[model samples]
Target: MGFDFLEWLNLAARWLHLITGIAWIGSSFYFVWLDNNLERPGSDAEAAGVSGQLWSVHGGGFYHNQKYPVGPGQLPRNLHWFKYEAYFTWLSGFSLLVLVYYVGARSFLIDPAKAALEVDDATALGITSLIVSWLFYHNACRLLARWPLALGIVWFGYLVGAAAFLESVFASRGAYLHVGAIIGTAMVGNVFFVIIPNQRKVVAAIKAGEAVDPKLGAQGKQRSVHNNYMTLPVLLIMISHHYPMTYGAQRPWLVLALLGATGIAIRHIFNVRHRNGPTGRWIALAVVLALVSVTYVSMEKSGAPAAQASVDPDAISFADVQPIIEQHCTSCHAEQPTSELFSEPPLGLKLENFEEVHAASTKVKQMAVDSDAMPLGNMTGMTDEERATLGAWIDAGDPE
Candidate 1:
């Protein structure tokens, strides 16, 4: 068999992205938990510049962790940095984005129904969004440094607006992924531009026997906390493509906003709980937000009805819809896909025959009928009428 270079390259980048993302997010969560759980240091330890400490047992060994408010009295000969994980994660993730979305823009990024963007324009827009998002977030942080509550509200509003704008231009899945990429960029920017630089300054000061600036430590802590809160939302966006119900909804941007809010609220509950704070109210809020998101996405929209009410269920049959499937779906869903996008049927679904199509009736109804999520960017130009016909067939129990 011949080698598939692009496929292997895509897999390698995705694998690296997953590995580094875990490392980066794991460290962020651990540090946040450790900081919240730390107890005040004893008098002697405080005198030696230790602010807080924690003791824990793991793998039959005990470990004690210490935090210095500014910098330790003396810099350690060897210090560990958590920057590379964030850097490499961003690199690999951007590589996958370019490989899967930009390179295959016609098949994955552009939706003619949304915007008739050429390949070059779509790729440029995606790249520009990343840069512009980071600039806006960074500047907002600096502008509202003294008022954290205002900064958070503004940031959340900006994200919602971005989701709406992206959904208007790019394909729904592409829009959702770009939102995730934007947030990820801001997170890594915090580590590279804010947190690490502040640490290095403090280290230099301590080594030179100069007093460290307290603001530097406070700034780093603020950004770290922000990263911790954002982790859950970004995680959900990463795997969202597999479940079309989210990005396929009538108002996909609203669904994204509501779900993102749910994730943030849930993340807040853990942060509050870790600090030994009462989490009853936050937990309640999170539950409510989650239910709202689920309900909103489940609602049927006007254009994309669940089934065609005018069509007689008894009249539609497998024979009537077989031609529609052949025209719009078989290219990618058959046992031997003719589409260049896949060597095998996507998700291992082969719908060239009645049995296979019937078995996947629900998925077809969801992706093709209820939402324009299939045909990958509407590459085969599947029509609204055709989708309704498919919906009617499935509703009629997919009669043969």
Candidate 2:
């Protein structure tokens, strides 16, 4: 139950990540709709390829907005950078990812049966893939963006490749977790590399009263758009671990891909919502149901889909884990654990027998995972040795 400084820091990071992600995503989605809905004003200013305009009331004030194809002229001296939300959101998210998944990877990421590597190797591969993914994506964006649909083709190939690689080497959980990390890394890098630099250059031009190049803005916008498309999927990735129902299933990577695609498509519905209203609503719903169908269809995969990894009651024996559990865990886990002075199982958990033990392997793994609570009050002074025995038991195919 007691937590160290780093564990506490992780808690704080998760809180901040959620707060800032909401703000960032809210603004991003809002701006997309705003851009789509702005009305065209055929004035002299309209000759400059200005597509639309809008008037709004908020905070007891009226606001007017305009859309220029690119640069209208020199940038404003009072430019407010919209880059911080992207940066802070990514920063807190990265910290949480490192804390929950990386540092705790032995408990969270490694799958011995699936991949015979130490925690360090899994962590290394995760980090390397994330960094390399960004580099590959950035370069490919710049290089092939001219071909119009090149981004889609490359993205599709990369997604399929990533799913295949993950399925080959790691368990379903490991593969999906890494996908989110990949996208999160790319989002942060977009801020530190492309978005910020271009904004700085544009600001410099504005300060010098020189003409701001339109291409700079275009490049930054393109990257931002990419981030927008990624937002929904990254969110699913972040929370996937908590839902064993999703990542624990068979063919989890396939689930990840379909869910991710649905995210992108759903974003388009919102992107055009302001312009098309109810029509856009249908598109978003259609994609959502299609995604649900993907998951449902996979469920009919003859019992080997990702999640039914077998609840073989015989697999995880009560003997190996029971004594260890009783020694440390039963103090609080029992119907009335003498160690904790409780009248009932802490979370109504009764790991008192083989049945209870196998049924709660997922919960056991989760608790043993973060060391959130067990051996209530450390009454029996459960050592790391005992924790490992329990964790590894679950990881070892949770065999009986």
Candidate 3:
């Protein structure tokens, strides 16, 4: 309960982590949107053959922006580098990964049923996957930067491979979170190695009054674009652990596929808009509807038995069901629950008395049986028999 030295350090780092990450992602997305929205400048020989262009005003100031598929004509002195935000975010996030998932693997990261990995193995898998993902992506980008279709095919195949990997080695929660962490790592690595170094060379060439090599600029742009596409999905996956069905379903990998695909499809619409082309609103809508449909599939599958056998009606309902709700569920689900854990009832579902409990019977069944939040099992104690009682109530129809 008390904060130790390392725990305090982690708390401080986490604050830094979120702030910097938002700055990095916000700027990146803004630029992409701006480049798509910019107008072609008059007398623009240097800006010919650009990806996209835009003009903007912010903070009582106006600015013009352009995307040169070839390198910029000149480099300005004292140019700011947008690299550290990506770097610090990755650094603090790694610290959090160690503090939360590695330290509490059984509850947060590990699933014994999925793999025989001990805590160390899971930790290694998580860390190694982060590094290797960057390697895979960077190499793939290098190999296919000139061939856009080839790059797309390779990236799509990589995602399918990642989905299969998630289903195989780690629990869905661990698997999906780790995959996002990998993407996060790749994004920062681009900032650190490829994009920054390439920018340095191109800037130096321009400063020397020499023509910048277009290839370096092209390579950097490619990596940066990949980071742009992945930003939304990584954000979604990073926070998804809090939602039960998102990362804790029977076919959780399928949910992951849909989430990633939706992120890509939405970004594709923006990319189209950026190019001064027709908006792909239909693609974005289709992606969202597809995500909803995929979620329904997981929900339908969740009600199926996670356990082997069914509970008896009379023995379970009469004796176990009502009492278990009072002891464990009511603490958090009551108007004035005596449980110190929650000050207010969650989801506004009350289970203070027999009638209130019956009225919320459906909610209780879903939360207790389908999700893991009712008794705050991860944060507190919930006996196996107590969980069984709640599960039995759901298995046996609610009969007053």
Leading candidate by TM-score: 1
Pairs that collide, model 1: none
Worst 10 residues of 1 by lDDT: 302-311
**Candidate 2 local Cα displacement, residue 314, angstroms:** 15
- State residue 1's C-alpha deviation in candidate 3, in Å: 6.4
The residue-by-residue lDDT of candidate 1 on 143-245, one tens digit each, is 9999998998999899999999999999999999999999999999999999999999998899889989999999999999889888888999999998888
Q: What is the lDDT of candidate 2?
A: 0.70
TM-score head-to-head 2 vs 3, winner = 3
- In model 1, which runs have C-alpha deviations exceeding 4 angstroms? 300-311
Model 3 gets an lDDT of: 0.71
Indicate the TM-score of model 2. 0.74
RMSD of each predicted structure: 1.6, 7.7, 5.1
Select the stronger candidate by TM-score from 1 and 2: 1
lDDT by residue for model 2 (221-311), tens = 7877777888888898888766655564455676677777777777767765667666556586756766684655456444542222222
Give the alpha-carbon lDDT of every model: 0.91, 0.70, 0.71
Kindly provide the TM-score of model 3 when superposed on the true structure, using C-alpha atoms: 0.78
Candidate 3 lDDT over residue span 1-400, tens digit each: 3335664676788898889889999889976776556665555544355555566789999876767665556554556778888888898888888887787676567665567778898888888887777788888887877897788678767866886686587766667778778778888888888889998887777778887788887777777888898888888887886676666566677777777777777787778866767766748675675768576666666666555323554565634566666666776677775654345675677876667876766666555556654444233455545665666665566555
Ranking by lDDT: 1, 3, 2
